[model samples]
Target: MQTPVHGSLLKPLQVNEAVGVWFHFSHSGSTALPHLPADILKWSKNYQNITYGVLDTPFQTVTTYANNSCLLLLDGRIDNLATLNDAYQISDPSVQSVVWYLYVTFGIKGFYRLKGRFTLVLYSVESEKTMLYRPYLSGFPLYYQSQEGGYTLSTNPLQLCDTKNSVTPLDKQRVAHYFTADPLKFSSHPFHSLSKLEPGEIVLMDAEGVEKIRQPVHEAFPKQAIPTQKDAIYRAYRRLIETAVSETLREDIDYGIMLSSGIDSATLAYHASKLLSKRGKKLIAYSWKLPNDAADESEKVKALCETLEIELKLLSAEGMGPFDEVGSMAYNPGSPVTNAFARLNRECYKLASRDGIKYLLNGNFGDMLFKYGQPKLTELWKERQFGQLLLALKRVSKKVIPAETQVRTPWLTDEVKSLRKEKTHSETGKTDYRYALCDFHEDYFGGERYLSGVYGITRLEPHRNSALVNFCLQLPQTLHS
Candidate 1:
């Protein structure tokens, strides 16, 4: 018997293409489709023609299974092919196929088992049910908008904004949160009509309406037994980092590393270079050179790249400031641009694209994963908690770095201040430090992912790997300190 395509199998796409998926589901069973902007329609048409159940671009591949009863759309790479293959007893599984198998076998709960940065959409035609999911700490963007008797979803939030209809209103609360919240939490979209799926969140839509589900904080970080010896702990940390870099490195696409003088990017570069060398490929490294700045690390970056036998591309951000390219940067992300260095990051991505790099790897979230607990230490010192401080110093470094001042929102109104107060209290009350760090990382990197997508470059951060995160969380508190 011939197997059905969409529910069980996946169709592959070219290496350089940008992947995105968009679809509309009408609860009222109306035949009329949502109005997609002409440019969006034209761009999507370049890769694949728009269909009733699927709207895809050449950059993305779509497949249907179970005799067209199910449709699966995936954006971003999966890092755990070997584990999934062994668990599911399948060989050579594509990302889409693995996701479909999991969904079929385990339902929505199967998504939690996934370890990577991805935004997935699974629609069941028979049941008229659509499920959208994003893993914890995933930077990939997924946006949806609900309308009268129906809803629309897309990887790009801009696609959901229909100019022919009423204007999309700004979400004042979200905008205020962007300015006042610490760690820059953004659980909602900047637009009132559209909503962004938070990290570790699932949205289910059907005839009954839309329901949002968030993973419990406690369940996200399960306890683990960690080695006590420093040497053993170091070995485990090294192994996890190596595995993360290895899995994210693909043979089909040319990749580059965003090198910095810091240990995080340097560590990733070292591992990535080693992996690519075995395949007879030289890794490319990109770093920002700020001329005339005493803090510039170009010299260090150059020396490290030389040692690794990697080609280094240094882009000068000499006179660049946070305000440069403000208009375009703000317009491109389809939301508020928070990262002060977004312009510089975009330039690096553009140059990488020109150099034929498909995937750009970075060491983001490294500090969070291997935290030093400096702020807590500083607080302990201030409170005269000498015993606790001594214990923390033994686990971490003896040196105590002064804590930075909180970001000030001078223009905050009374209402925004109240919102910020409530938000801060909730965030501070969380017991799982790892989960909170993941949330902060998601907010910090999500905008960067959107910015990189504009240049057709996919950003990969190995530090965000689930196994590595869980391992770090399980390590003895002293090790984390």
Candidate 2:
């Protein structure tokens, strides 16, 4: 195994206890680095690459291997270890060992089959190439910034900026998107210099510069005929859920779920409880009770947790407004906040972290799987499908539009007209799938990163798995209804 690089620079930057990593790649010998957080596992440098890494919450132990020809850094769980070990004809296996073996055996093709939330940085002397990648449905954040000869890569954007010689700037477009109700769904970074490595994307760097080696990570909606039978679709979904949840439950650590009254969280809690119970463990569920009437969803949460025999921890966050402690909360530099409940969310995570819970299974993006909020009515009207349009509007009036929103119908109409007068990226798509994509980027990727950073916890949203998402997308829209 490779050892951590020794020696300090002219001025080293300070690193937080939270999980983070930062590195600058240069062909000119070395790049100045920021002081690393206390949680980092390794900070190594060679002629071609300099890397900084921190142990991820659940995956705290990491083994680095380096020689004159290849350098490997891995910080997360690898689920298919046995298969990889068998394929490479090895007895002992670890994420680092598997990654090195796979690369030596299959080159870049080795990453495609990788399963888990991980950030990997590999440098090859023979090929003179540096590659960075994460899972298809990213479990963690990975970002990069191009430089003169090479580039800088980091798990934490703030750390990159904090480097002693760093000059990264805030990205205006990304900031604007974060403040808006509807943000663009595409991959973007909060900083002008850094870029988010989209799900399943892999980028290779050399002496010349950095370049995306393949198309964006993850598959798009399929164009083929989808499974038509509801029973078959349901069965497939069940299997996917079971597999996803099972793969995430680490036997050595205690895990919890973010339970709410919503179907998504309830479903996850039920299944997780059932699976863990079989292993002689009781699943702990966390629920936040806000002072606002709208935030009260305890009735269903209580019943579901009780039925599953799960340990429910009800947090009374009464009088804790969404905007409370906004300025004082753990601040991730350059991160944006659109929701007022960020404070409450942070409190829940802090509690979990304090209790030594490293993982929290969330049901984010679950509604998208069922086509919950399609702009179908708006599209129907735009298409001039008068008959369908009328039916859609009527259905919307009955089931979609809330009474509170109806009361401000005239105001809403005026606001819509005003919005049309302005150039907005949110107005790009008119389909449910498009909206889902946007929401996934905004709500899941952007928001979760800040939350995860503040509390030192990893949020696992298995519903956002690429396989599950592709399957749902392939099914007919009729099934969604």
Candidate 3:
């Protein structure tokens, strides 16, 4: 048995708790299991107390079911635990146990019933098949690489690379795409050999090879005719937001929100504070203050928090440079860190950790879902509604108009540009603005999940709730403004 060594070149950060799964399968009838890194092995020994073939991390669990015929590694919570518990009539069910039961009972199709941010890996010993599944809107990362006889799968791309060889080469084409294309739409990893599974993607591997199945984007964000009346839309929007916020709040644990001067975070803070206040609990709000008060929102955030009756904690970026801890932060996600706000984000997460907060709420993607304005103009142009287009342009800024922007790497060779595959509207269809937006921003969501995991914090985005997204997507473009 050749033990697959975890690639040391991409060293992971020293996180308080992290969840990852790594396994290699061979088509040559090898019964040997893949060896885990020393750190994971040691952590499992000290914390999980499991023997071989069973490893558990603080936020994830590995379970074997079906009389040991199947093994499952699960990360993230299951939102519909109550329904599953009632159906199975099991008390004190862990996410792993509930998922294992669903898989054994209904197979892969059962995953559709799940409604949460999670990634699952299931291996069948008897069938010699391995399945990697990530549900829709699941921000958790799952990567894989095909090898000689089979393939290796892992939550961290670095783990898939074999340390026997030199560090994996950077994918030049993907790097070019990162500079030329929209970062949110670019899904390629920096490493050439790694392949990330898209949200709602299922990879089935057998002796022959690997087959991928993806849930349609439209299905994930189905279109509905939301009444355009202002009052009706407002009522629906308010109800969805409130429900989403309520569902994300946990009674047993204290959670904090990343508040800003904008309405996005303020909305979350408002609802969260109200809900927690009912239970006699205080909601903590954390805001990042820019140095020298350069466009700082600290005062606004403070006022909002005060009005909401929640405690406000401000993290000053006074002496912190943009590239502070850039090296370590880049490796945390096992990919390139393109966001300039990475350093600031890491500092906020660090502050939350110091405050003994394990769950952090944010309104990161609320704007994309609720306040997107570009699509309104795009739809007008496509339909040849010049009159309406002009009126819309008057309401929107000149920046909303699409224009050719110079690539960051202006000297890129023609070859790299040719290799770039610009995203198409075919997958989402031209008219499905909501699906396109969600698909485009998938990477951002995954990135946040990775960064939060580094601090053992579960980052919740109530705005990304399926129902809320659907409702917001269906609202008329006028309402978005």
Candidate 4:
């Protein structure tokens, strides 16, 4: 058996904790990180102790820092030496080295300085204090259980691999929300234990239990600063590419990028190709050839890849008929998001497995991360950063009236904002954002336990880095300008 990377569940102790929240705390309990090693075949008894894994490179390092006192697991790469040096006094040396330094220097507070889409855990071995955090709106899928008799956290549900702690099932109200909720925020999952940490949240857990103390996602969504309309679009657009490209390549394994004809993938592919071209390595590109072969974007895809000089790996959509069939036949909790996207991910996993690649990047979560749905902008925009807000509005407009947006047109129309609900702090008995964030929790993002069970493949969405999102969120309304 391959050695387990992280310490085996020496004991999958039944810890009653809380689930699904967006929060942070002043004084909290300890946290833990249980990460499997890269090379371990299997862990000790019941997979209790890690047999394999290390953090030597950026590609496939599933480094788990544990003790009787703590546990931390991550799915991201940190790239801010100057920030690190200024914050923790760790100079530019290497990512792993800096991680150790930061760990030694700031313990929990240091996390704020971390810049990536990493799903992290802090378990207090002594206090049994536990807390989990995904990057602030970086958009890593963080499934958790915050109820009696069960409290577990995992990057994806599959990693936990225990039925006792898995989801039990859900009620009909959640199903109703899943099917008809406006904007369709609630997700569907058959197993009961599942819940996602809302974007821009810091969850705290302890003996008493877990509570997501709310915080603002952004002020009224108008967004932060910008100097000009053109600058807003340019910065937002560039930030997306810069984030997606630089961060995902941190895994300690051979990595690949998912490519397709869509602007999203093309955009990622465009930047990746440029980066890989500089190094002597060809950007290993993977694409899913649809089973029907009718919706083929082959010409556009091929032309782009060739122009960029990227090495391509084309996988058949039907190649994994057995795995797909098996997953569908037994469990697959009718994911409301998009199965085609999941299938694309599955195919990417197959590509990784077949070619011995450990890490692969895909364009998932970009829609939510970038808020790709343009129409929502009018409702979300805050006035503090009008210049930046206008640029985002323009990009959003392109999606709404693509042809018309191609030519210059008057972008700001208050009529749209007038039609939408105002995000007033005082009117709803809410002055700070935590209230609405919690409202999103109780009413929308969390509270619904769906698909808390089932095997989910590991996917790297580098663009969901916390630093990038916070930068976007914290920007003045016109920063994009």
**Colliding pairs, model 2:** 13-34, 13-35, 15-36, 15-37, 185-438, 200-217, 322-340
Per-candidate TM equals 0.66, 0.64, 0.67, 0.53
Question: Arrange candidates by TM-score, highest first: which order?
Answer: 3, 1, 2, 4
Give the C-alpha lDDT of model 4: 0.42
Poorest lDDT segment (10 consecutive residues) of candidate 1: 46-55
Candidate 1 lDDT over residue span 42-66, tens digit each: 2221112123211122233333222
Cα lDDT, all candidates = 0.55, 0.52, 0.54, 0.42
Q: Which stretches of candidate 3 lie over 4 Å from their true place?
A: 1-18, 33-57, 66-69, 81-107, 125-127, 162-190, 292-295, 319-340, 364-366, 372-440, 445-456, 477-481
Using TM-score, give the best candidate's number.
Answer: 3
Ranking of all predicted structures according to lDDT, beginning with the best and ending with the worst: 1, 3, 2, 4
The most accurate candidate by lDDT is 1
Instruction: Please write out the lDDT profile of model 3 over residues 213-306, one tens digit for every residue.
Output: 6565566666666765555655666678789899888665678887765434666777788888788777788777766645455676676766
lDDT of 2 by residue, 1-481 (tens): 1123432321222323324455567765453333322112133332333444432222233334554455565545566788878876765475556776778787776786677667677776576677887665554566677665556776655544443232222342222223222222223433446666654556677666566533222233334444555445555666776777776776646777776654345556666777887887767878766666564666666766666677778788776555334422233333454444444455567788888887888742223343332232122112343334234334544453344441211112332233221111222232122111323443334345445554667677767566665665444332333
Query: How far in Å is the alpha carbon of 325 misplaced in model 4?
Result: 20
Off by over 4 Å in 4: 1-111, 123-128, 137-143, 146-190, 219-224, 227-232, 239-255, 291-295, 315-340, 356-358, 364-459, 466-481
Angstrom error of the Cα, residue 290, model 4: value is 4.0
Q: Score residue 106 of candidate 4 by CA lDDT.
A: 62
